[model samples]
Every structure is written in C-alpha cells, then in structure tokens.
Target: MINYRPKVFDEASKSHASKKLYAILLAFIVVMGIILILESIIPAIVSTKPMLEEMNENGYLENPDNFNFQESMKLAMKVSSSPSAMIPTLLSTIFGTVTAIFYCRCIEMRPVRSMGARKEGFFSHYITGIITGIILMSAITLLSVALGVNKIEICHGVNYKVIALYLLGFIVQGMSEEFIFRGYLMTTIGGAGYHTGIAVMISAVAFALAHAANPGFGVVPFINLTLFGVFAALHVVVFDNIWGICAIHSIWNFTQGNFYGISVSGSNNTESVFRTTAVSDKAFLTGGEFGIEGSIFTTLILSIGIASSIYLIYKRQQLQQKKQPSQE
Candidate 1:
C-alpha cells in the first residue's frame, strides 16, 4: 500500500537533534539580518546624492520621529522596482538556500535533495502551481467584482517590461519564502520527532506571525495566511517537492499586485494592467487596503484549497497502490 506519511516524518532519524535545529535557526536569523542590512545600505548609498541635496535644501535631515513605517515601506517597495531590488531578493534566496544546505548536508549529514528539492518534475510542478495561483486569484477577483465590492478598470498604457521585472521579483520572493518556511522550517520541525501535522501547524503559525506587521493586517488576513501555509505544507507532502508551492506563492502575489493592480498584503502596486478600486464600506468583502487576501472569501477559498490538497494526496496514494502487483 502507498504510504501517506510524509518523507520528512520518515526521515526524522537522519535529522539533527533539537539543539542543532536551534543553532540552524539562529544561523538563518543571522543571514536575514545581513540581508536586511544590505537591503538598507545599498539603497541608501544609491540614493545618497538625492538625499543629500534634499537635506541641504531643507537645512536638516528628515526627522525619524515623524516617519511613518508603513508609508516608508510602501515607498521603498516602489523604489525597489529598479534593478537594485534584485540584489537583496537574490541574496535572500541564495543565503536561505545556503542555510538549508548547511543544515541538511553538514549538520544532518544528508543530501540536499532529501529536503524535497529534487530537480525531477520541477518545471512541470512549477507550471501547475502557476496555473493554480492564477485560477484562485482570478476567482477571488471575479467574486469581488460580481458583488460590487471592487471595481477593476483596464490601464491602456501599461508597461509590460516593468510588469515582467515585478514578476521576477515576486518569483524570487515567493521561492525564498517557501524555502524558509516549507522546505527548511517544516522539515526541521517534523524531523525533530514531532508529528508532521504539528510541524505543519507550527510553520503555518510562524508564517502568519512573519506577516503580522504588514499594513492593513487583520484577523481574516492572519487566518488566511496561516491557511496558505498549511496548504503549501500539504502540497509539499503530496508532491514530495517544493517547486510547485514556490510557484504558487510567487504567482499569487504577482497576480494580485502586478496583474490586477491590487495592494498585495497592503503594499500598493502602482504599476499594473488593471486598476482596482475597493468599495470603502466593503472592507470585509474587498479586503480594503490589504487587498482580496484579507477578505472572508479568501478564508473560504483557502479552506477549500487545504481540503482539496489533502484529498488529492490521498487519492494519488490510492492510485499508486492500485498500480502495484497483488501480494497473492
């Protein structure tokens, strides 16, 4: 019979101890610190000339006390659309991959492929994820439109090239997140003798916590984000790989911000093919400034997705068992 147990749970014996997992997690934190420092430093250096001129004209530097964190983050994202954004984004993923490798290969004494990063079927899974993401996000958009919760207008003079760059950025962003949360954190926790389902819940909680500080964040978005994590973990367990979830996460955000002109997790995307206008009074339905992901509909959709993924996993196992020879 086909086993429904996750390979990660089965491979727990090969994993490092709890202490080692903590150290590895600390290493990841350090790497993230380095990434944040570089992201800030490089951008500051590039903008030094303008900043200096503005400071001189104003007779003083901008006051830190009056700074708005949300607005600043949005502005930073807008500015990062240029080539410069690639550095931090790429570094984040590369360093994240390095951390995973260090733990899997060095600490755990296992092959990196044991972490479900095998190249076989990578492209196919990624393509499937992209389609899945498109369908989900499009459905959410259509529902909002039908209910008069959102108004979407086509932007005639859209810059396809910029949109392409943003797509690349979101792809990297999504892959990095998947590598950390699904590939690294989930595997580590599950391989530490904990139940794989528990690991999934923990990782999902962490995923939601990471985005807790995002703009327009609310209870609905928090729950939806957690559900997304559970869905992604189940996806990995079913497919035995991470490529598909990475693609889904990437395309989901990209379509929300770049294709549909919605605020992705509350970060405004000024460049898009469509301009989305949310009904001011329908924040519960339209997700307000947090975009559609913060809505009740998103919760329903994600719940369905999670259940479907679980069903598919079991169904696939049944099919595989049916193809085997009888013991008799």
Candidate 2:
C-alpha cells in the first residue's frame, strides 16, 4: 500500500522526456564532455608550473622511454594530492551540474523544480544533510579505529589554507554528481513510466560503473558505490528535494578526505586534519588503496542508510493515505 512518488517524478513524467536509455546516453555525452573540457583547461591554467615541476621530479621528463601507465598514474596522483591542482580539478565539476541542468531544463523543457531545485526549506534540509553526513562518516572512521583496522594521527604542519580550498571544492564536486545522477537521471527514468525501483537500480548501477576506472576499484568497491547510489536515490525520493542529498554528498567527501586525511575514492590523500592509516593488510577491513569507502564497514553503513530511507518512504506514503480519507 506504500506507493507515492515525489512531485518531481510526476513533473518529469509530464515533461515527456525522451526514451530513458537514449536520454541517459545523450546526457552522459554532454555532461562528460563539458566536465572533461573544464577539468583540462582549469588545471592547465591554475597548476601548470607545479604539475610540470612534479612531473620532472618524478622522472617523467628525464626518462621518457620508461614513462608507462604506472608512471603516468603516479603523476596523476601527485597532481590530485596537491591542493592547488586539486582545487581546479574539483571546481571543474560544476560543469557537470550545469550541463545536466541545461539539458533537462532547456532541451527536455523540464522545469528546474522538477529536478528538486526547490527553494523552500532548502537551508533546513541542507543543514540536516550536513549533520547526517558527518555522523555517518564519523561512525565509519571511529568503528574502523576501534577494531584496529586503522589508526588516526594528527597531521603536523597542517595547511589550513589548503584544507579550506578542498572544502570549497568538495562542496561543488559533490553537488554536481547529485544533480547529474539523482536529480536528473533517476527522476528522468522514473518519470518516463519506469517503475521507481527500476529507476533507482539503473541509476545506482550507472554510478558504480562510472567509478570503475579509479585505482583499487574492485568488486567490493563497486558494490559499496552502488549501495551509496541506492542510499542517495532513496533519500531523494523520501525528502522530495535535491538539496539534502547535495549537502550529504558534499560533506561525505569533505569529511572523508579533508577531515580524516583518507584517500577519496582511490584518489591520493590531500590536505587533511588527521591522517587515517591502515594497521592491517586486509583489504576488506581497510579498503586497501581505495580507502575506507571500499571497506566492508562502508557496505554495512550504506546498507543501514538504505534501509532507513526505505522506511521513511513507506511512512510518508502511509501518512498521505491517512489524509486521503479525510479529504474525501
């Protein structure tokens, strides 16, 4: 009896979006292209000298013959680990948000509000999401420490400036992915007459596949990422807005990388307040090179989050049903 799709889903359906698969493919091309262009141009403009210096020091220049995939990846990691380079890299994600919004709003003629860009209660929802994000991540980190899978140490000579930059960058980066995946993709599919479960599953799978190229991305990481997608999608459905998910995504990444000094989804560590290092070689426990996001702990937490969201959706549906009788 619990069945109630959000207003945004119905709104998107009324827009008559193109066939789901075709829409997803075209949007992928458009959004990825913009992100690629901005990612390349911004880094080139902002971190050109520092990147070159790092590359040369890493022997990329002196030993061109030996520069292989591993060497290339090493250089890439160095760039990502550097705050100046990472800022531009992260900031470029805004294009992903913009491209998805433009495609849905202008091309499909869908209203922006249909994508959960609502103004009412935006601040409240966002603040709540931030709190939720901090708690979830803290639980994972703390639990890991308690089990002796990881150890935390305060960073010496920490650069508050770089940490601030990362915080700003993660805010944009997190919101971009939410807008693209949850706000745009999931709703578009659901609105096109697909079952809500199908919409959520497809979007979740797509999210996991998108991260396949990252370092240390294995089966566990893929599962964890997909579960995260499911959690986020359900949260959106229950809250009936995108702002909460955006804040959650932003704070989740910020807390993981900047607050805990852990690698963010297989990326190298950046400026963090405290460094969390693995005490064991168990990939299931420490997540190996992918960081805690890939660990079994993440799987457990995301599963709980998913379950909680499902319950909320059900309760909301029940409340609506109770009101229907009075109105009649």
Candidate 3:
C-alpha cells in the first residue's frame, strides 16, 4: 500500500515553510556521512587487512610497509566483484533517495508526482541529459588545459559490460539525485519562503558536498559537480520533466566508463573503454589523473554542448509559443 502525505494549504502559488523539513534534511546529511565513513573503515577491517596479510605471507604484496594506500584503496572499492555490487548499489539508490525525500516531505509535506500516464518521452530526457553531460565534461577538460592541467590517457582493452553497469548506476544515481535535490528539495525550500536563487544554490552546494567521499572528489570535482547541479536545474526549467536530464546523465557516464575506460569517480570496474590516452599529468589540466571530464578537451566539448542545449531549449520554446492558436 502507498502512503500519502498532504502539504498544508497556502493561498499563494508558493507554500509555507515547515520547520520539520529542515530538521529532516539535516538528519539525512548526518546519516549519509556516517555511512560513508563506515564503508571506508569496514574495507580495512575485513578484506583489505586480510588481503594484505595473505600477500605478505605469499610475497605478492611483498613489502607490507610499501603497500601503497592508494592502490589498496582501489581494491577496497572493488570489494565485491562487478555482479555483486549491483545489489547494494540498487538498494541504496532506491531506498536511500526515497528515504531522504520521504523524510524531507515529512517536514514540508506533499504528494509524490503522479505515476499515471507519463508526460515526457524518454528520448527528450536522454538527449537533454547528454547535452548537459557534454557541456560539463567538455568544460572541465578545457579548464584543465587552460590551467596547465591535462588529465587524459589512452588505454587498451576496455571492459564494456562493467562500464554498462557503471553507467546504469550513474543513471539511477542521477535520477534519484535530480528528484531529491531539484524536485523535492527545491520545492521544499522554495515554498518555505526562501528565494529561488537561494534554494537552488543551497541545493546545488549540498549535492556537491554529498559526493565528498568519491575517489577523485576534490575541489575541482566538487566545483564541477556543483556546476552540474545548476545545469540540472536549468534542465528542469527547459523541459519541466526529468526524462532528458536522466538520459543525458546515463549516456554521459556510460561514454566515460565504456569509451574512456577510467575509474568513474575514482573506482575501477570490469568495463572496456575504447579510448585510453592521457593528455597530461597536471591535476589542473588533466584533472591531475582524476578523470578526463576534468581535462581541457572535455571543457571545450562541454562549452559547445551547453550552448547547444540552451539554444535548443530557446528554439523549442519559441516554436511552441508560435504554435499556440491566437485567443480572440
């Protein structure tokens, strides 16, 4: 059975702010932080320690002292093989986002959007999302180059299936994120009496902070992700639908994992990325070995993508306005 929650009535198009909403959001942040910390620790306690000891005994990891923390951390992220990771990842995507949004709703109170006949087409969602991705990736890539940071490298023998899964994860993650941050969070805060700009800015910043635990998450990544959040909001403005944003995100990520063959947010998987060539070693230019999305080439590509998406939206809006019959 579905649980329904009704928001309080407000005469204005905007709704009243609820103290409860902010409280719930705060708690969500705290819990999420705790979980990330625990995940980091558990790997060392169980798998990492055991593997290192075995390696020491067998000489595979010959030098215990020389055991590179970064390399071990990479293995730790791969705690479970590709197939197994899906279970927890899916659960987290569904349960985590739902739980957070529900809690937020509890404070603000509202109905979930109708699950009835869907309004938007999948292609619209996918294409818009791809445009967003291209813009973002290209932007970071170019910025890195301008700043003397080239973070790209070509690799052979990519893992396609694993890449698919990774991209799927991004889709799930991106959709859930957009819903919570843009849909729920944006409405909650905006209705609660905050300016639209404030609400959007806060939500974007929050979204970036949420990923503070990712592998290559740094100032650059954080700023990039925040920009991503803003870009997502713009998507909502243009389409008033989630379809495009989700599609673009999924494709963008898949392209990275399958075509580029690098760690998505710093975690490796069983996937074959066709392109494997580093542009440089500077973090500023090449994302400093973090990922190509942070490279100069990606930056240039993103700039074009962003302009294209915007132009499409504007053109679409004008056409729709023109198509409307004149009222007598």
Candidate 4:
C-alpha cells in the first residue's frame, strides 16, 4: 500500500528561499540558451535544400523573390509540424529535464524523485490521467457540436504510423511542461516556505504566460490555459506524483490533434482522423482557430477537474488519519 504521509510534499516545502531563487534564475538561463540553440539548428535540419527544391518545383514558390524570410519561416514551421519533427521537439523535453535535475541536485540538495517522480502508483495514476483527459476533451467536443458551433467529418485511410508519431511527440511536449511547472517551479517555491496555494497559483500563472505568444491567443484562451495549469497542479497534489498529470497532458494534446482532427493551441496536425469545422458565428463556443481548448466548455470542465482533485486529496488525508490510529 502506498503511504499517504505527504513525505514528498514536506521535503519539497523545506527548500531555502535564497537557494530556490538562485536556482530559478539559473534554470531560466539554461533553458533559454538551450531553446535558442535548438531553434537555430532544428529549423535548418527540417527545412533542407531538397525540401526547398521540391517546394519550388511544386510551384509553392511561384514568385521566388516574394518568398521572404517570413514565408521561408512559415514553410519551416509547416514542415516541422509533421511526425519527423519529433527529434527537435524531444530535445526541448531534454532541456527541461536537465533544468529540473540541476535545481534538485545543486540548489534543493534533494533527490530528483522528491519532485514527485516516484515510481510507486505511477502506472495506475497515469492510466487514470489518460482517461480523465479523454473524457474532458470529449466533453468539450460534444458540447460544441450540441451547440451547433462545430461539425465533425470522418477522415478515411488514416495512417497509423503518423498517429503513433504524434502520440510520442505529444507525450514529450506534455511531460516537458509538467516537469517545468509542477515539478520544478511549484516544488521550489513551496519548499521555500511559501504556502502550497500560493505556489500552485504562481506556477499556473507562469504556465499561461509561457504560451502567451502562440498565434490566435486571446483572453478566453489565456483564462482557460491558466485553469488547466491549476487543474494539473491539483492533480499532482491529489495523486502525490507527476506521472498522472504527464499522461493527462500528453494524451490531451494527442487526442485533440490526432483523434478529433482539431487544432491544439492554435496549431493543427496535418494527419488527423477527423476534420472539425467551426461555425463562423460561434467563435466563443467553437474556439475558432485557437481550437477547443480556448472554448468556455474547457473552462467548465477544468474547473470541475480542479474541484474533484481537491476532494480526492481531502479524502485521502482523512483516510490516512484514520489508518494512523489503527497502526497505534
């Protein structure tokens, strides 16, 4: 049986403020450096000479002189959206993992596992997270359909290999964000004597800010993203592990982009099983170009998720307290 003593939380909450602050600064510098390096190398690798030649031959560049840097960059981004882009995206997760390790070892003087990477209960929690994510996303899609804000068309002859690649890519994307926000920032801040509530809020806000530059981002999307952050943090607290939240994050994106054939945070995957069309007059419900994640339905579902996490945590605490007397 898993112990519900909050041991990881206690250890993380004991981090020194000065050390945590310094670690945060160092992590920021390292992550930014890594991103800049990868941004330069990955684009060049993905947008090779042959690819450009093919584009020109295919009449994609009818006016070569008109193909400015912006257009070239757009082509690069399009190419990078494919499954072949996995390598570059995976590199991002590596950077995040390295930053977390640096802070845990050098600053907090604790094992990396203390950041909620414990192996116990990982599989079960991860499966639960996957189910939860699918249900939430399905709910949002259904709501949109019912409201006449979106329509879905079935896509045939889907390539399973591409779907597999997207799954892997989304897994990397999801876990990377979780490691940075819930694992590193939340633990470091909470460990530095800040209340758990404060840490969760700070981390959630940071998560939202991190995606502020995405195309088509707006007030509703920003609010919904922040709510997602809060829900993820609460999920970690309830399960006392990061595995579940990682699964949820990964499967959520994969389902949105691959299964439902909808854009995820303003980015669309060319290989999808369904084609979702947004009603022109219902941007608020359909989330328009920003995808279903920006819809009000998302906010409602995530709020319920947050509340559910809180309830589960409370119930677990009570059960643990009851078990204490039995042991005595």
Give the alpha carbon lDDT tens digit for every residue of 1-328 in model 4. 2223345567776554354556665665575466546544754575576467757865767877777777765666666665566445644565566666676767667767768888888889889889988988888887888878888888999988878877876787788789878887777766666666777888898889777867668988999999999998877777678889999998898888889998888775567888888875666787766888888889889988888877787788788889989999
**Model 4 lDDT, full chain set:** 0.76
Runs in model 1 with CA error above 4 Å?
1-3, 11-13, 19-94, 316-328
Q: Residue 270 lDDT in model 1?
A: 55
lDDT of 3 by residue, 167-260 (tens): 6667766666666666665545555555545655677788778767666778777666666666665555455555676666666665665654
- lDDT string for model 2 (175-206, tens) is 99999888888888888877788788888888
Q: What is the C-alpha RMSD of each candidate to the true structure, in Å?
A: 3.9, 1.9, 7.4, 4.2
Better of 1 and 3 by TM-score: 1
Rank candidates, TM-score, best first: 2, 4, 1, 3
lDDT of 3: 0.54
Give the RMSD in angstroms, all C-alphas superposed, for model 1.
Answer: 3.9
Model 3: which ten-residue window has the lowest total lDDT? 2-11
- The top-ranked prediction according to TM-score is 2
- In model 4, state the lDDT of residue 249: 92
The sequence of per-residue lDDT tens digits that candidate 1 reaches over residues 1-328 is 2236577555644765453557656755665565455445655666555445544454444565544565456455555544445334433454555555665678667656656787899889999999999988888887788888888999998888878877877887788778778777777767666666777887788788778877788888888899999998899888888899989999998888888889888775557899888765777888876778899878888888988987887798787678776643
